[model samples]
Target: MSESTLTSGAPITQLPDDYMQNPHEVHHMLRAEGPVREVRTPQGLKVWFVTRYDEVKTALTAPGISKKLMGRVRHDALTEHMVFMDPPHHTRLRKLVTKPFTARRVEALRPRVEEIAAELIAKLDDGDVVDLLDVFAVPLPVAVISELLGIPIDNRDEFRAWSNQLINVSTPDEVQAATSGMADLLYRHVREVQAAEPDDTFFSALVHATESGDRLTTEELVSMAFLLLVAGHETTVNLIGNAVFQLLRNPDQLQVLKDRPELIPASTDEFLRLEGSINIASFRYTTEPLELGGVTVPAGELLMVSLLAANRDPERYEDPDRLDVTRPVQGHLAFGHGIHFCLGAPLARLEFDVALTQLLARFPNLELAAEPETLVWRDSTLVRGLHTLPVRLA
Candidate 1:
């Protein structure tokens, strides 16, 4: 830890532009100082940022640290979702959707995911510079999740438009409008499905779901659908994009995976650890005053673990900054930890493993078409992905 950095808090806004392209450097600076520090989000909310790996694992499951910040959060649609709820509520909601999101169910989509990737890659036959994020990474997950959830194929663009607004904090109108629109759509769908008999589709599954005896209410159902549909694809889209970006930069590692295509699974985890999609875990507040990472964080104050930072913590993984595709990544927090661990992890991993392998195989000489310095990154404190990845597949 440096003496000067200890005195001056690291401002999230003033982080170097390189931090946007690759945030691990900024994360390294914060982790070097200590495990946890205070900072203001782009939204101007003062919050404690948890940076170390061990501390993050502990904080994620801390009883005093909770996700139930009822009135504190502005977005009500997201409020009733499992990610935002504490225990009983979250547990109940999760159980209903767990059946469809199980490992077996996700694996069943293997052929479908592979087919989707192959179909998308087949379109890139024009040997020209194309934005992979647009033609590949972005569409693949949206299509897969929408299919799994029985969301109409026609709704993908609206979902993306609304979801983009929902995830980014810059556009309050967009976020609000998106949330409101999703609420109506999900609620209406739930009711429509419930009015008739249910099917095996995710929409029908939730509409008729019963856990031990209790069922998700209209509000809870609406919120769950919104969260699942948005989160289902958003992170994976970034996962696919981030993996390609890292591998393109580290050609040796890329070739290692290319030669042994079996290594794409491990490489997915490496990318999650090295350049994870989420900027930070969603909001958690201290349920009661408690000591964390040597700091006495008072109750009701906002707290979050930098998922990307913890994954890169030197204390947890050796050469954490380097991208090693063959490295073991069994317990990485990219899918998070504790009761709130991502339910869609199975699906996300399946998507990444399938998409990356197919894309690499399809474009044997794939490389960044643009200079690295000229790349544009999406501006969101919560997501880490290139806005567009221009690549040459020839």
Candidate 2:
């Protein structure tokens, strides 16, 4: 798993220990060698890793590739949601929740989102050294999603713990525990929503959502809730954390943002391109022999698209590694592409805009409390984010 192994052109057996901390070096090598490479994930699952931008896009939308997990039973309630399904089923589940996250509906939430950011920032004193993820990044989106879904935020810490375990846990026992805890908590909430009168909240709507006389079953309701709960906040948490971390590392970029705060919204995509929350899109399997990037992947092999890698492909961007907040980053695959594009992209963008604006306005002298190299990233290929972000709020 050393860097030299990547240079040898032999298939990568396992990812380096620091892959989560920084994957671009490996991405660069793989992109240069070929468009696709066979690699065993840190989890020991072999997959056809799609690296180059064009091929990644093709793999994302290819008819021969399937989103459904092959030869495995549904592991938990979370597995039943849209991210793991193909069309018709994915279409149905996604349609039921799409209206609530539309651009107009999300824009209407701007004021509330601002208020949430302000309230959270208000609690931190200028001189205090705090783990920004816990104090700011993690809670803001959790609150927004909780309120939107009409779920109680009183147990947010527990929610955060459940999310962390489910995303990063390496062992089956841990995964089972996290899955059970999330399923139990969400099932109770879904039942409560079902008992109450239909309301405007997203969860309530899902509980009562209908399309052409078809309604979500109880299991489907709970599973959908689980997906929204996790997907809603997870991306924003890392987006905010990673953006701040990058700005701190690049002081000039930080100053530029502080001086011209109007650029905050536009910079969201740039941040996403540099350090998106999800490293790899969810799992896919080939339904038939497929040609991607001149490589023929056999039928039924596991497939994964490296979004972080594709965003930095030299063939695509003029300067892929540099952090320039003003750069035009329109077509980035951070929120993914095609029909499986993130349902919460609008909300995630709105949150990033508000969070960064309020944060820089309040503390212009923010800096990392720990050495840059000392910060630990979460140990999950599915998520690319720090375990904590310690910052001096000056």
Per-residue CA lDDT of model 1 for 185-208, tens digit only, reads 776666777787877766677678
lDDT for each residue of candidate 2 in 212-241, tens digit (9 for 90 to 100): 888888888888888888999999999999
What are the clashing pairs of model 2? none
**After TM-score superposition, what is the CA distance of residue 198 in candidate 1 from its true location, in Å?**
2.1
Best by TM-score: 2
Q: How many backbone clashes does candidate 2 have?
A: 0
Give the runs in model 1 whose Cα sits over 4 Å from its true position.
Answer: 1-22, 153-155
Candidate 1: the clashing residue pairs are 64-287
**lDDT measured at residue 326 in model 1 versus the true structure, 0 to 100:** 89
lDDT of model 2 at residue 216? 85
Per-candidate TM-scores read: 0.92, 0.95
Deviation (Å) of 85 in candidate 1: 0.7
